[model samples]
Target: MVGAKMSNNLPCGRFEMRISESLQPFIRNGLKGCEKEGLRISREGSISLSPHPVQLGAALTHPNITTDYSEALLELITPALSDGSEMLGFLTNLHRYVCTNIDDELLLSASMPIGDLRSSAIPIARYGSSNIGRMKHIYRQGLSYRYGGCMQVIAGIHFNYSLPESFWLEYQDFTKQPGDPQSFRASAYMGTIRNLQRYGWLIPYLFGSSPAVSKSFVDGRNSAYSNALEKFDETSYYKPFATSLRMSEIGYVNPVQASFRVSFNSLDEYIRDLSKATSIPYLDYERVGTKVGGKYRQLTTNLLQIENEYYTSVRPKQLTRPNERPLRALSNRGIQYIEIRSLDIDVFEPSGISIETTRFLEALSLLCLFHESPAHDIRQYDEVKHNALAVANKGRDPALKLLNKGQEVHLRTWALILCDQLQEICEALDNGNKARPYTQALHKQMEVIRHPELTSSAKMLATMRDQKLSVAELVLQKSREYTSHFQKTPLDNSVKRDFDLQVANSLEQLKRLNNASEIPFDEFLGNYFSKIPEPAKFPGIDRKASQVR
Candidate 1:
């Protein structure tokens, strides 16, 4: 194991006054995992009309592979591992396996999918006739209705991480005020989630790569922010200093979700508010109707069909049991890890991400955990949202300002402060190694902040300008390159055999799920909602959702 030296001053403020040497190994070796999503486009760069490849196994039962909102939008997940390199290698292998199985289709490398897409054209994923399968499909149907299918096709990556038990145990001992180990761990993760949101705008400014998008993203409809985007050739639209259009108002932001009031202040508050949203009826969704024409239009008329529908940049996560709700799992096991959902897929990488990105994210997770995180109220929450959109829309603009503690601060100034603190954390993560991979990752990102033109968003726009290529053309070219890159590198026989076995097992699992005896759809929904009992409140946590966002 790499050795980390003790440091007196870590720029970690009061929270990390003295991080123990025992915790250093866990910080350096945090478990990292990734969930990458990409659109499966035809060779001509249009959305693929074909169903998910049968060769890859049933989308319903596949542990590592599944469909997102669309039948053609593939999501690949990697198991959490201590080494970032191993995590990335596993992700690469998953990509190779998918490419080998899917014939004549390419995974679009860019986050903002470019195609002649229409709401009717994109196929919603099907998971067979089981009750649970039907529930999944119907929930997606609700999404398509609430937020158009066009927006659902915008793909990105999710970074999942958790500090090791050693770190948590040492941390619990350090804090000394915690009740139980699980409660302390959950509280610590909640703090991390809050900090992650507080400074998440930096994510887009540094790594966002979706400044330009296809004209068809709006599908011939007049967009409210049509004036915000300038024409990039006849076939595309773009924002001059935009970082991630995928994160901007044009992408994932929506009116219904904008009004969502879930809390990151505490696990109990989060579960209570989220559970209430899932149960309380929303008038707008009510019009869609739970069952219309004898078919389920959605799972419910509630503000959220389920917890997953409430979108955020980050989420406290717990692994759920079979047929268990995500909230129930968290209430049962505390936060097992956190899922960082704001990263845009780097078009330059064959696996949609890189080892540097993973290492950097792991370090960031630790920084958030160790840093002081104050509880947030509604005003602070709105500020967070405003800053996120500002950075997403115009992060590269020289005059861009973001809200910091209700005051406007230049984006670069705030970034520098964060990076300086991050450098110390990364140094400790490097553990006196000569390679300094973590520090190197932080340095590369610092360069992007110093020279905005070096950002992925800027590079994407520059590439388009230099080549005089439309967004579709440039992304399609990269799609072809990535397809060949993955296909040409054959998976090892052992790995190939393992994937084949998984495929077979997934198919069998789906069959069993579909054939198993089950209750009626209405009864299933009732039972599901009924199971979300009010969790025992944490010792000092405020239960009011109004106190939070």
Candidate 2:
């Protein structure tokens, strides 16, 4: 089926006539099988204030496990895998491993953390005596001062994905482009990223789960959403039509990053903009100061402490060696993968995410890649940002309207059109398999749109309203339920041993890093910042000149 369509006229004839002719077979072969995926799932849970049995130190040294911002918050990561089932299985085992180790703690199943606790009560993650470790801990301290620690505890999942190198090679061969392989691949990935920015609002509409939060989460803050105050009944604060308060202005939204103009046009533009932001000092952050009372408050007083500080819904990424900066890695090598950072943890799934959701996200990414992506100006970028904010706050409202090509369109109408397009991609992905998981997942999203009450956020809100429970109370109840389930169903003895080994090995690795340091901590910090190469001098053919329109 995909083979027949591959021969059809390429949209807008983006490729040369001869190149387009060669692409049919390549597209057909590429669409025939499952693509591999890399996933990183992060979840945060508060330790019981009365019985804090686990130390944050344990999370710092663990490889597969770690804390995000607070000692009470735990994050589990799974290695990249071709099989979604295998990935979920690994995540489950990691959760089980953590559960077994924590004597009297529970991993929160909800996206929002416990709301009753004060910001000062949450401990930042500490990574021993190493300079790098201290840098990480201090970065969190800066985040705490910048955005209150309560907000930092909100958890979510990151899905990292890349088409196989073989796929890119096939694409390059089909297009007959004249550039280095790595540069071509990076440009191709950037095209997909542009499309994602244009149409990413649909994501929160479909999967966003944090419709409400405990009243304490908004306490003393100037909130723009009047629904919270009007709807509050001395327990939960929420908007009736909200999808994810966690993704909205009330959550991780930083005013400082709101106007950041990082471009997706090419690798150089992206690196240049990000590099400039990191080097440019901000008066607000300067007021906070890098150090207070001889203690490091942050790594720097720049608009961004580092490239990772630019909080976007998606990012182009390359894995780095120890002590290597992320932007430096990209400047030297190119994008290895793209990270989807907007997904909220689905409370219904014990693994924080389900295989079905993973499949849908994979399908969405492929759609983004194959679509006709155009270069976007700052106006379009702002439009995309507005759409995402609207969906996060008022997505469930049937009358919600979003900007599409500068025209107002009903949210449901726009979403349904996207879902239909996604179904076509799902068919290509399913290959010849009868049990089409991708198509099923798309259909499920359609159902959620048709009946907004069926969305996860809506369901959570309903439960809270009916039970007269606060967000903290509901999440705590769910946490205990999941913890008990994990306790009863322990991992296989071999799996348990493997995790124990990983824990031991990670500790040893940390010790080695600490002992091997030769440079003074202050000197190491200066050298690291000073050595960040300018983007124009980045090692790659200047592919920006020949970028696709």
- In order, candidate lDDTs are 0.84, 0.71
Instruction: State every prediction's TM-score relative to the real structure.
Output: 0.93, 0.87
How much does candidate 2 score in TM-score? Answer: 0.87
Model 2 — which ten-residue stretch has the worst lDDT? 32-41
Report how far off residue 238 is in candidate 1 (Å): 1.0
Instruction: Compose the digit string of candidate 1's lDDT tens values, residues 252-332.
Output: 776665555778899998999888777766666777798999999988887788999988999999998978999999999
Inter-residue clash pairs, candidate 1: none
List all candidate RMSDs to the true structure: 4.5, 6.8
Question: In model 1, where is the ten-residue run with the lowest total lDDT?
Answer: 1-10
C-alpha-based local distance difference test score of model 1: 0.84
Candidate that scores best on TM-score: 1
Clashing pairs in 2: none
